[model samples]
Target: MGITIFEDSYRHKGLRRKLIEELRRKGIRDERVLNAFDKVPRHLFMDSSFVEFAYQDKAFPIAAGQTISQPYTVAFMTELLNIKPLDKVFEVGTGSGYQTAILSELGAKVYTIERQKDLFQSCQHLLKMLGYNPLYFFGDGYLGKPSYAPYDKIIVTAGAPEIPKDLIAQLAIGGRMVIPIGTSDLQVMTTLDRISPTQVDIHEHGNFVFVPMLKGTNNR
Candidate 1:
């Protein structure tokens, strides 16, 4: 098997510069976040049918009835995480692996868990194809990945009944987690900054709607 010359050629004369400029105009201010968004090709993570909308700042459905978060939402969440080069991030929902890919681009070592087996497998393949280094897993998104405990940042992509105690316990001292909490149809996006063993700060971003995060993982 040989590499495609046209693929390399198109990449050189690619769609990225325009994408970066558009994202900037949309107010994605963090240069590092922007660079990550710029580097990971969103179109590649999506189905061919939706590639045209890849850079349009909108969410699109992938396998397993999950969506690739809108670019703005993904950037907003990632920015809230306040990723540092040394941060080890635990992503609660793998979705289409778009957010995980973006986090990887921002230089975080990502450990993401997805409940849907098909979506998990698809995303794992996509990330590998894109040369992203993420530790993808199949399991409930609720518990978070305890094996990689004490993460610097944790982000939940779906709405949960409450902030899972399991995930909070897994947060490193002084680390932060950005999550969505409430019923499936209605929720609040919040950032929890842990100051100590018994101290945390909550900054809630009014409202949002997300799929319910189910418990009882099939992980063995």
Candidate 2:
């Protein structure tokens, strides 16, 4: 479903504030991430039926059989990347475009990819209408976007069976990538810091669940 509602009421702001406090209690300490959350109206990214619950720290179903990542999950992954202003960030999934907006709020030059055509189009439209300017791609994210290679940071929003090498190759030396790797049911959130062209530092953050990252685009 496309985002049809644009109004963010006082109640919505109040609810979002509560959600941010909840995230803080959950140990999300990055003030920048919190401020971004405070600015973006997440309800605008959600379908109308779920808009009322948009501020909750939970994931909800969107179109194309995909689920938006929970607010805490979004904050966690984003905070891990430690995005710098104007950092070129390559995002693996553009589902809902909520994360993309958050990245834009952080002043990242975002290059986001979505394998699902429906999501790619809808997210692109909504973000444009909302004033975000991320470069959007409708293709297999596994291949990454080589045209804009050597990104300062990479974030894969889905659970991948394994880290795609192409994405790693696209990362600039000293770049960091946050991806969830494991089976379909569970994934360990992992970070790869490319210290050099041939070397990386790997660390596991924790376990989280996400929709599986697919191989190719889905036109339907």
Candidate 3:
């Protein structure tokens, strides 16, 4: 019955502070984004053995060969999306659901997709336990969930060869998407703002490394 996993607040607090300092050094300026970073108990999103390092501004390995996105990466992407309270968000990789938790905390209605069955099950349970009602799905992120198409904000936690055209098509007229495109060895973190049904502006903002985004799952 590993039903309850409480975060070590005292330890996380110090690391959380360190994470914030790193964000400042890295030019993450949104205060709301910073709050999301501090409030989301990231330690709750990692394996117990590594909870000790959860807020270190570094990615920690989670199940299914996934790493919880770095704290600064979360903050940076959230800031880039400029998500409002009423925005509907779609997360391409649920992983440990830490980013999903932050999105929910920021008042965005989240629908997250995780391909690995085990990771999906693990993240879904933890999210439910935390009282976050982010809709969880086991499927290929390459094909954005059509049932929830027209998302106001979409974020991909894994690296893609290119922004999935289907995902862009799913974005609302004025919606935005943040994704890491290119290869793991060299990926560019870019934000796509849908200017219209037929036009979008791409803003490139440095780079990151992540596991490759794969296709398909057993949700059939």
True-structure RMSD, every candidate:
2.8, 1.7, 1.9
Q: Which window of 10 residues has the lowest lDDT sum in candidate 1?
A: 1-10
Pairs clashing within candidate 3:
none
Best by TM-score: 2
**Runs of candidate 2 exceeding 4 Å displacement:** 1-4
Error of 3 at 149 (Å): 1.6
**lDDT score of residue 131 within candidate 1:** 85
Model 1 C-alpha RMSD vs. true structure (Å) is: 2.8
Against the reference, the lDDT scores of all candidates come to 0.81, 0.95, 0.86
Q: Write the per-residue lDDT of candidate 3 for residues 41-153, one digit (tens) a residue.
A: 78888888986677677888888767887888888888888989968999998888998998998899999998888888888777777788988888898998989888999
Task: Tell me model 3's lDDT, rounded to 2 decimals.
Answer: 0.86
| Worst ten in a row by lDDT for model 2 | 1-10
Model 1: per-residue Cα lDDT at residue 80: 81
Q: What TM-score number comes out for model 1?
A: 0.89
The runs of at least 3 residues in candidate 1 whose Cα sits more than 4 Å from the true structure, single-residue gaps closed, are: 1-16, 218-220
